[model samples]
Target: MSELKIVDTGNELRLLGMDEASKLLGIQKSTLYDMTMRRAIPVVKIGRLNRFKLSDLEAFINQNRQEAQS
Candidate 1:
């Protein structure tokens, strides 16, 4: 029997760029930027760079889902 091993990239918890976050969320890049500018989504800024955490994105999605159902 062969066993499959999973490798952790460590990026799952790290910050993601706008494009990366958009891709992950399956949304348009422009929409993500607009949300960020409006403070409608969670994000972190490091100097001149904007970053989003995977955890924060997940939470945002969950919150949206709940809001839609309510």
Candidate 2:
């Protein structure tokens, strides 16, 4: 069997586990899990584990950004 390795390109595109993702979003891990279950968030499935892309999460935040009323 061939072993798979992850190569870092020095970009902001790193896979984050549930704990890191939740902390980055400042939300509960359960909430992040729920979001993934509901397909409201982008996720990467590795076996039975859930992984998220830092860039994707940043995009989610950007897409959800709201401006103050003038």
Candidate 3:
């Protein structure tokens, strides 16, 4: 995956490339790819390319968030 910059239009869903998604999640590209392959993360297929939605990524983070046991 390349560090491709996706254009954002008003009222349109924001899509990100693998590199951007990995960076946003603070993980390596390989890890992200593994998660995608395992179906652990939501991904969008754009005709031979992988894309991630900003809203979906945010939802994934929220779903996986764990509260600290104090």
Candidate 4:
């Protein structure tokens, strides 16, 4: 599996879990789970664990925002 990196506030990077990703994205766990179920969100599954990179989530949000504006 590839590495998951998170860009910190200080411009540093680290790995993050589902809970952290949800909190950072300002969404509920169930909502994140729903997105995953619909394959609407990008995720990394390692073994039985699911993870997400901050950059990926940000990109997803940006893409959605642009779509909404259009």
Q: Which stretches of candidate 3 lie over 4 Å from their true place?
A: 1-11
Per-residue lDDT tens digits for candidate 4, residues 1-70, read: 2233444685334446889888987899999988987999988887888788667787777666532253
Of the candidates numbered 1 and 3, which has the greater lDDT value? 3
- Model 2, 1-70: lDDT tens per residue? 2322334476666789999899988999999999999999999999999999977787787767676788
Top lDDT hit: 2
* TM-score comparison, 1 vs 3, better candidate: 3
Better of 2 and 3 by TM-score: 3
Q: Could you tell which candidate, 1 or 2, scores higher by lDDT?
A: 2
Q: Using TM-score as the measure, which candidate wins? A: 3
Measured with C-alpha atoms, the lDDT of residue 34 in candidate 3 is: 94
lDDT value, residue 38 of candidate 4: 92
Q: Any idea how many clashes model 2 has?
A: 0
Off by over 4 Å in 1: 1-13, 66-70
Task: Flag regions of model 2 displaced more than 4 Å.
Answer: 1-13
Supply candidate 2's per-residue lDDT for 9: 73
Residue 26 miss distance in model 4 (angstroms): 1.0
lDDT of each: 0.80, 0.84, 0.83, 0.75
Candidate 1 local distance difference test against the native: 0.80
Which residue pairs in model 3 clash with each other? none
**Residues 1-70, model 1: lDDT tens digits:** 2222323379666888988899978899999999999999988999988899877887787666532343
